[model samples]
Target: MEHTILSLINQTNRNIFLTGKAGTGKTTLLRKIIDTTYKNTVVAAPTGIAALNAGGVTLHSLFQLPFASFLPTYGSVPLANELQRIENRTSLQKHFQMHKNKIQLIRNMELLIIDEVSMLRADMLDAIDFCLQQIRRNRLPFGGVQVLFIGDLLQLPPVVKQQEWEVLQQYYEGMFFFQSKVVKEHPLLYIELEKIYRQTDPVFIALLNHLRENKLTEKDMAELQRYVKPHLGTKTDDNYITLTTHNAKADAINARQMEALKTPVYRYEAKIVSDFPEYMYPIDKVIELKKGARVMFIKNDPTGNRRFFNGKMGTVQSLNDERIAVLLDDADVIEVDRYQWKNVRYRLNETTKEIEEEVLGSFIQYPLRLAWAITIHKSQGLTFEKAALDIQSVFASGQAYVAFSRLRSIDGLRLLSAVPQNGIESNEEVLQYAANKATEGQVQQEWEQGRLEFLQEMAMRTFDWVTLETAWLQHSSSYSGEIGNKNVYKNWAQQQYAKVKELVATAAKFSKQLDGYFRQGASVEYVCERVEKSVEYFIPLLSQVWYQVMYVLEKVYYQKKVKEFVGELEELSNNMGEVVKKLFRLQQLMALAATGKDFSKETVSTERFEALFMQIVTNVNKQMKQEQLFTKDKEEETPKKLNTYEKTLLLWNEGKSIAQIAEERNITESTINKHLIKLIEEGSIVADLDKLFSKKEIEELSPLIDALEEDSLKTVVEQTQGRYSWDKLNLFRKVYLGKE
Candidate 1:
């Protein structure tokens, strides 16, 4: 079952929900997917700790979403009334101010793995959908990124305040992610793993299954009653961690036990280096431990020896600022070392043009935390050898089941109170959804069918020229040079852009023909033959045109002592270089597929893909760095070499008007105005209406710009005719749109 699901993830672009009972190796399967899949992927979870446990970032952190209850607005553009109701004016303003690099990350993402998705609210999922669409400029679900949701719907549930739910209920059927409006439009492929790896006792497994379905029998009740002991809560035990429903109860238990210890305390503070954010801290910054205190390991041992795993119960035998020893159940004492957790984000490597995870910072700390007691919510992915259940205050649907499932067997569980008849609860909505899940045979059938569709989509995408065209257009529009005649580079880029636009038209016609062939029930061999012809046609056209585009730029840079535009030149070269690499890879894949090879088990490796294009420049930025482009002018004091936006900003700060700066900088006034607007949009500089516009100008153009439905400055200028210049309209539009 796990093998089939893994194949679906790699061979198709389906949105999948991987669910199972607790201890069904869902996390194990997730690790396998992360290790082996060739797609550019991002992993996120609902909360910080869950994110830490899953080795990913938080959803809110990844999306830059305000911690607010979102409303399910239908398109990328949210309904104005509903948007105002969901978030405040300030947050909405901030949401639109995402950094350009973050926007690029969103555009480059191919797969998104959301761990512990049962705790993801319906509105939150819709908000993620909306965010991706707005940022990636694509309206497909999650901006055309395949999403994999991993969690048990029978374990943890999403948290929503009563007041928030009152407002959200009208827009949603329930709080789970399946109830999201977008998920309803494009339903997820449901695959559940049935094997239980945590517990092997048949009787215990039967009881858990009954509890999960809320179908407890009389025999199960009798077995559970045997562990009920009212006096157990009063006892102090170091071997068993107490699991409770509320944080306050768990905190009190841990605090009391800590205070009772008479041993001297050893205080250790975590070593944080560089850009680790406060919210994403995996463990407490400072921990105070005593010799006999109970501790729980929060991370798996870094060594392959597997001496200690997460949630392993032990007692602190000895500790210091640098070293600590833990005694496990079998009288084996092991020395524990500090573990480092890396905070990472996905980025496109300029040299390789591959999406890679870049480590932003790391937090080094001991992996142990107080294990006297823990809340059931925090114990979602943890397992225990012995635990006491204190569930009289259970509040959520699966609270009791989550607490009970943490133990290996009934022998490891001690009940502090008799289980109420209604304690083993399951949401009716979850039950109804689970009942409709396809059987194993049906899943296999769908998987086989999806494989062919996946091949078709891959072939279509290879023929689709939109991505390459967009890259060329963006590069051509943003091209700027500090040395030589800038028109030379600009004209060349424009010509290439024009060529790409023409190719886009030609590819669209070819794609339509290919679709017709597929619609006629063409065999794989027939389609591969068509793909082979297309590849042979496009390969020479792209390779011959783009092979020396970067080499020419390199030669131009080497001939001059230009330092101001080194970064910009490299960036432009890299953008074009990435396009060339992608085009070549697409052709290569199509050529390979023409051999009638199966792609289910093996896809194109990076090495093999690069082997096809090594004759082209492998790394445009490598030589630039080695030459030390900026060192020669270090002592010249050339105002620190500002970018176009920065230069425009500096001139403005010197009280120069837009026209004056344009004349001084030898650029168009419209380009100068655009630079300042870009600076304002990035929050680098604030716009002052009094400094930017005259009263007469504001009073005349403000109403017109405000009333225009579209926010494009060129559109506003066109409507007003040649009377008003684009520079004036651009400034007026920014102020009127409240971006200032």
Candidate 2:
């Protein structure tokens, strides 16, 4: 069970299906992935409530897919008229053409995480697949992107219209997305969490397991009926939440309960400061609350102080035009503050391997919801300490199971009507699948082994970096150390490794956490997050710090290369952003140590040499602090320091490769592509490009390359498919594309 969950922590980018019975921490696992992994992940759910619960967007809202019952059933790109019709129907044409950025976001996506997977139908999933392929211009499944599916099919089955089902049946075996043609062809690896975390009573747990496995018997039904009675008692503070089959029925209970309070009702209209005000409506545009009304916090506290949390229920003690007070179930009364919900777009910083959010707009309001009585349909991702059920009102399959499972224990449940012995139903296909998965304990073991292998590989790579750092410090320099001290460079190297050693040790902590996670999924992803922070974010920047030293040393031996490097710095500084001030200062040091300067003896009066050297060191040190390179909770606290294209190219000119530049800059290649496009348009590197390729070659390649909008080597390789080598493509982009 631990491996089934922990295994994804280290696994390379791949599609995975995380499924289990109610309250198995599926949503918890998704949050962990969002907190740890470096991939550009976008999350979506089939329903708005599910999307908010998942802290993501709705599938339709994110993709702008049509609301039609069936998706287009075809393998090829639609003709012009067909596309036009789709555009007119869904308004996707303007979005696709007007939003170049939206296209880039989709094209560069590494992971698309869908929560509450059971509610997404086969046609809808195929439709998403088609949209991705069309936007990315790739024919591969999901446009060659990795997707994560999270939810249990046994709880909620997809809604299939008769027409959609008829169209889907030709391509899918069933209505579930797993039965879709693309999924059938490229099946995602399954990981079912076996541990039950929501319910504590073993006997009650056994009944839930039987429900999931389709093994419910008359005896189990009799056990369930013990709590079911003809008349439910009057509402009390401890009464379980009523579950109904219909929204209207649930609304009736809520209205009646609120009216029963006989307290003054305050109606507050939400203030939306965003473009999509209608979409921002979670429960409604106007929220009605009364004193003594049972209400739940719809969002976590902004600072995450835990004074309030999503799904935490309480009673409204008082309210006015300027204030609101809530008494939590724990009897602690606190003034409630308004929180802002932003509609954010994320950009992956390839250099940092961190997701950066751009706040497009926001909805500012107190996140409180009426909680006296909620429908079983609306109660789906929530957990309750106490609950009541009206199983007699259940109209669809799995509704009863959902209603009963919200309670923490059987003792908390009070059912208001007799339930049929065979009233509850689960998807038989899912039950059979879970049954089969139950026997494959080997898969879980394999997951553990794979984790060990990834950790070992990381350890080995860390060792290689240490070796590279040490050799560069010791052997690469043909000259002596800082003036008046032959060991000045060696001392600098020592200082560098001391930091490296510290970071490596910081990274090693994950090994212990992996051990802990192998036994219990630790609530805090301490190791996964710290390792990601240490290696991906900090170490790369640290490595670039060493590369700076190399750049200075290289200037003495490779004068021409050093000249090219300085030119890049000067040109980049000349462009729109701030100058790489430290590197700009380093250029002066290189000027003093030009072509044949001997450093075997003290050549400088301490004042000049020490002053300049100290300045360089101080500048580098200051940048590290600004970036918060050593902070443990930087991901949560610090704002990102983006590496401008000029600085990225300066590192490039220092002989660092694109991958190294990405590490040094802390951003991704797609993001890097955006920077380079701006650089080309700015004419900052026109002279450099002229030297790399002839004008004729540049002209010939520029138009041919224009056919492909992106400057990535992969795009060139993919479009030309070996007609040109990577070197040629790289040189062409560097020399030709941004002609001045």
TM-scores, one per candidate = 0.76, 0.58
Q: What is the C-alpha lDDT profile of model 2 across 262-378, one tens digit per residue?
A: 888888776777554465466666788888888887777777677876667788999987688999888889798877766655554422222456666667777887887778877
lDDT of 1 at 720: 67
lDDT of each: 0.78, 0.62
- Rate residue 221 of model 2 by lDDT: 79
Quote the positional error of residue 658 for candidate 1 in Å. Answer: 52
lDDT of 2 at 284: 69
Model 2: weakest 10-residue lDDT segment is 573-582
lDDT of 1: 0.78
Candidate 1 stretches with Cα past 4 Å from truth are: 74-85, 88-94, 234-238, 467-484, 489-502, 529-533, 551-603, 608-615, 618-740
